[model samples]
Target: MMASVNEYYQQMEKTGIPKRFTHVLPPNEIEYKNWLVGQNGLPPVEEWRDRMYAETVKLLKTMQDGCKDQWDDDYWTAVIESKGVESPTNGHSLFSRCS
Candidate 1:
């Protein structure tokens, strides 16, 4: 018989982190910006903003892959807000607590 989703997640969790966990971007995007700064160039602000936005989305996808439990948005938002990150103004704010 097929295992229930919860059972499957529990088993996977016991086996250490999933392979997708490695797909996350480096925790410090600032390092990338720093490298850019060292390169002697500064183009349109909106372009950098768009790159940040896209990177943020990719990071969120990585988080989703690592989140074995199928938690709804409300649960996650409440968890985030409860942890004093009411707005999660930055990417690290919301995901730094992940196991």
Candidate 2:
């Protein structure tokens, strides 16, 4: 029989691999998490995938929120000016230089 999720999480933590590091380690850890959360009769591969996706979304949202207030127009203008590069004109956008 498979171990319960709590048991599996405890085992991983005791082994010095936090559950979050499953994103970077071998597939076995992720498989184990999936296996633990699955129904007794069938595996919940979709659920595991959704969980990972949700983690990524959460991380992105956190990063975005952290930077949201730190990057206003004046900030970009100062950054460009400091680098001796001309800022974009009123009619053009920053991305225009990339084209």
TM-score for each of the candidates: 0.23, 0.24
RMSD for all candidates, in order, please.
16.8, 14.7
- Among residues 3 or more apart in sequence or in different chains, the pairs in candidate 2 whose N, CA or C atoms overlap within 3 Å are none
lDDT on C-alpha atoms for all candidate structures: 0.52, 0.56
Compared with the true structure, the alpha-carbon lDDT of candidate 1 equals 0.52
Show model 2 residue runs off by greater than 4 Å.
1-29, 47-99
Per-residue lDDT of candidate 2, residues 14-59 (tens digit): 9899788644635465676577767476666554345544554555
Residue 8 in model 1: lDDT: 50
Task: Estimate, for each residue in 23-84, the C-alpha lDDT of model 1 and write its tens digit.
Answer: 34354445565667668776433343445465556656877556543334454456556656
